[model samples]
Target chain A: MMTYDALSFLLKAVIRFGLYMLLCISIYMLSASLRKKSPVLIVPTFLSVLISGSMFVLYDARGQKSGLDHRAAVRWLCEKPILFTILLFAAAAVLLTYVTFREAHLRRTVPDRSSIKESIDHLPTGLCFYAENGRVMLVNHRMNQLCHIILGRDLQNAALVWDDLCGGSIQPDIMRLSTDSQPRFRLSDGTVWSFSRTQLPDMFQITAVDITQLHNLAQELEQKNIALEELYQRLKVYETDVEVLTRTRERLETKIGIHSELGQTLLATRSYLLDNNENKTIPVEAWKRSIALLRQNIVENAEQFTLQTLIQTATAFGISVEVTGQMPEQKDVEKLFLEAATEALTNAVRHADAKKLHISLTETADTYRICFQNDGKMPETQVTEGGGLGSLRRKAETAGGSMQIDCHPEYSLTISMPKGGTENI
Target chain B: MTRVLIVEDAPMDRQLLELYVKQSGQYELVPSVESAAFAEFCCRTTRVDLILMDVCTSLYANGIDAAEKIKQNFPQIKIIIITGQPECSFIERARKAGVDSFWYKTETAESILHVMERTMAGETVYPESTPPLQFGYITSDELTARELEVLREVVAGESDAAIAEKLYMSLRTVKGHIQSMRDKTGFRNRTELAVRARDCGLIIVDKETE
Candidate 1:
């Protein structure tokens, strides 16, 4: 019987040892649950309580079977079951308080990530965050507002909205749109949304701003610049007209001077011949010839100095002249031809000491040309434009024509003008 | 007989002068040339007592310039400078060139024969004033002596610096004179004033100088 009692005691000791280990395991599990604030603490606490109560029942059965000495030795474990359970509850409460303080400190140390997300969402500019997996992870309030304007709905289905904006399905491998490709979205309200994406390893951020007003202003400025360019072109034309008018005034002044000088000369000659009429020594034939010559010069000089007149005048100066073709009919052209002829004759006789002059008037499809050549002694080198030739060149150029001098074989003057006189100048 | 050298370019003018000299009965015609340089050469080679010089020779040697050279070399020979140009400045320049007499070809009250006789008799014949030839709004008398010289250079197509060098004036002075001329005549540019001055026959220069 005693042996049977000893075996039962050994069995109680093994049960108490297992219950002690289980209680330690329950406390460890409770501490872990307190850190997480999980509901799993209740299972560990119930198991500890049931095991402690069974230990109490096992202690009472051992006390009944054993003497008082053995009962006294085990009373500390058996009699204080409620207190131990209360102590265990107190330990759990302390752990819970410690965990609550730790959680409060942690909350104070780190900011809430959701608040950052909410801050970006409330920004005025459109913002969107894309995950590495190609999902639309976060969208700001402006982005949502943009979607509402474009799609007539909120961005709860942001992936579909993004696909619609892209005009195709999103590729799975691409985290976000390429940075080089700045895609733009034009909404129904005529607001232009230009997007730029910033990429990171795990995600990318897209920003959009409205540039519609700026774009319209730029277009308007471009049109104004074009108009300004056209005005500049017109000013160039007016400048050329001013140059031509200036030259014409000079030519007219020159004509007036020539006329005045010629009148004075003719009057002087008439008075000389008349004053010398009664001289006994002067021959009558010489007198008659001088009167005839004076009268012819007056008639010729008075009635538009023609090419023939130029020839006669040069011939009178002891220079031989050969002329071809008829003079131009236009009064202005005739005057120009006469002036040029006279000037050439003067240059030939005086400057070049020319004995023979050859003149030709040729008409082409668009031009009237007067060519005067003299067998004069010209310089071996190129001649600078003198006052006479310079004036002729300026007049010819102003009239939308040109004049050239050739001094190789002989001294020659070529004056070419438009037949119709249709020049911008 | 006083030998005469006629340096007129026109055949008619030359013939008229020939008749006047022959009619004078005391003068003999030397075989003449048109240019003044040749006239100078003739005076040097042959005996010439009087020279009737046309101011506008239309040759490299202007009559005034040729007269100046001839008078310098042959101071004993008398020269009568004649021109249709009515510029008072031309007479002054001819006087400076040491001409013996001055006569206006068309406007002179005295005949060429009368000027030649007076010049031979050792009288410095000069008109009181040049004939009045109207230009734009003024006559050639409106310009000063220096201004006339400057105008001739301008008509010769000389640049301002070249004109200044030829006239012994600063470039600024030359430009200032041109600007004043433009303002006086109401001409727009130098070319207009110059071209008009040349056409008026106010001042004659050698074409080679151009």
Candidate 2:
């Protein structure tokens, strides 16, 4: 009898230890489910903890009322069919919690197909992959939006859209398509999108990149190039003008030299002529050299002076040239008239000793006439045309002009030239 | 006696100018040099009352340029710019440089000694007009100013279109001017006209020799 009682105590202690272990396992599963936020594991773990705790509490209370120990109460509860059923339920709850926890862990670690699809749909650049049969394999949100805006429909066949874009058959008001080999589209919002396609193993990929800033920069560069070219042309013209100005200045210098030489020669001659002493302050050889130099200068530069220059020269030589009319505007006709005036001025100064000369210019519809008269002594004899006058007459006649000498009537010389006289020359 | 400095490249011309200065009895001869480049240095080192500067000198030094620099530093001294070349724009450049006088070596009627005396006596002597240069059958003064501009480009061997673009004239206007020049000068063609203009020293296109 004492041996039976000891075996009963030992059995009670083993069952009590097993019940405590089951209760601890259920509480641990409940805390783990709450931390993981796994609803599937939470319900089973909560129920398992409740069932084990209530069985232990009911047996301990009944044992204390019957004046039995805790180990004895656990042994008595283990013998009941309800305790076995609760144990089976606890085992099933634990299996269910473990299975639920493993599934939650896999869901947190690995990405699924739907999440990958969602990620691709939100990319910035438009991307589309289409098979040879025109079936769209994958397309991003940007690509779909672009297709809707361009084609007025949802993206269905990327190949057909690419073909349409390449054919340049899209609505031009909505998007401006470039005509170059590479496809580029300019939208109504002033956004430039550069589109390109690449061939994959069994499909084609199309990408649209935003290149508005680059496009604008390129256009600005082109305009600046044109402006630079214009500036270069203007600079070239300025260089040419400088060259011309330099040449003109050189010619002016030459004219100044001639004037200085002539003035000096005249002064020297006048001084030599005035010195009447036996021992002349200026020698005759000096006079001869000055005269020879003057003659040579006159021969070389006889026709070099312009009308203004001739008038200025006459003024310098103490002869005033008074004009009554404007000179001819035609270059050739004016040249002939100047030649006549030159000859007339020389004659008036050398022979007639003129103080003032008068020039009258008159123009008609078909002809221009100029008359030269001086305030000097009238020719006592009939005027004879010398080398100067003869050469003037020939030049006048060559240009279809006529020269007349009227010495009897105040020694006036008139030259008449037909308009367009340069043609004849 | 006024101290005069002679700056001429040609040995004969320099000797003649030196002789004239020595014989004047009124001016002292400073040591002469071949280039105007040393004029400013001579002025700095010694007493200089006058400078007879030639347009072109040895070592490619331009007299007008050097004279301009010297006048800027020493405005009290008198300078007479002289040149034998007819195509250089030295007279105007000399006047702009504030030189006292200008003398054309080949075309001057008065002696160099007289020009020096006048310059020393506070006179700024310059020629009144250039000697007329003959271009083909006509003188340079016979052509209009516009025609001369076109002729310069022609002498430089520029094409008619290029000349028109540079002068800002229409091609047809350039052609008309060339034709008018040819008619006035009685040249058979443009080549003959350009060659004659270049040969006669009417318009020099090459700056290398200037």
**Which residue pairs does candidate 2 place in steric collision?**
A254-B130, A255-B129, A255-B130, A256-B127, A256-B129, A256-B130
Tens digits of per-residue lDDT for model 2 on B117-149? Answer: 899899999876555677778877788879978
- Cα error, residue A334 of model 2, in Å, equals 39
Model 2 chain A worst lDDT run, 10 consecutive residues: A296-305
The CAPRI class of candidate 2 is incorrect
Model 2 misplaced regions, further than 4 Å: A1-116, A175-177, A271-425, B1-210
Quality of model 1 by C-alpha lDDT: 0.66
DockQ (0 to 1) for model 1: 0.03
Superposition error at B78 for model 1 (Å): 0.8
